[model samples]
Target: MATVSEVGELLIQKQQTITSAESLTAGLFASTLAEVSGISAALKGAFVTYSPEMKEALIGVPHILIQRHGVVSAQVAEAMARGAKYQTKADWAVSFTGVAGPDELEGQPAGTVFIAIIDDHDEVHIAQGHFAGNRQVVRQQSVQQALDELTNLLSKN
Candidate 1:
């Protein structure tokens, strides 16, 4: 898988910026990008919306969507990606929302995750994942998966 630094380099080469809206992984997605040197030139910003209210207020994810689909659904993930793109005004954006738990959420089992990516053209791609581990491990795996997915998508673009 491509590293976050490699993704940053590609974005810089394309003269584009990227942003992230995170939930279960917190700011891990953004944190990984920020770790790359000179990423500020291509990484516009990131929003760590760990709560439903912040997701709605900060990233413009609709409360209704969250209510209907719950926080860890594909719909919420897609909305978050689009919302992050708008909020950051970046050429690309990614969002992650999921249940990384030792328990279930909204009838979904633990380790259920949804990762979404939105490009400049408004095209959105989503991937569903189920990881095995404790809460921390699930969250860490989610971040790695999200970064890998974003790297792959950016590479394609």
Candidate 2:
């Protein structure tokens, strides 16, 4: 697995721009990449869409999609990724939507996460994770998992 800095370096090497639409992890995924020096060359701005309305308003996630699949579903995750990529015109877009809590959401247990990545070719990859941890831990784990997935995707390209 690649570290966050390595991922940033990879993005810079490829001259690929990245943007994110975050739910559970808020802006952590973008912030993590921002830690690398010169990351701004490939790190575009991100959307911290914690609410459904913001997801729709900011990222252009369809309201019907959210109502039908729920915010945490893979469909919504993919939509968020697609929206972010389209909105920012970035070569890559990563989205995080999850239940990182001490309580259940829409009958799903805590730590239930859906991550989606939109690659340069407009291919969408989604991952569902059932993590075991406290609220903060779950959020952190989601961010790490996102970076790991992005690394894997970039490596294959």
lDDT of 1 by residue, 1-157 (tens): 5677778788888889998999988888788778888888988889999999999999899999999999989999999999989987999988889988888989989999999988878888898999999988888788778778777777777
- Model 1 pairs in collision: none
Model 1 Cα shift for residue 82 (angstroms): 1.1
lDDT by candidate, in order shown: 0.87, 0.92
TM-score of each: 0.94, 0.98
Off by over 4 Å in 2: none
Candidate 2 pairs with clashing backbones: none
lDDT of 2: 0.92
Against the true structure, whose TM-score is highest?
2
**Cα lDDT tens digits for candidate 2, 1-157:** 5699989999999999999999999899888889999999998899999999999999889999988989989999998989999889999999999999899887889999999999999988999999998988998899888889988989999
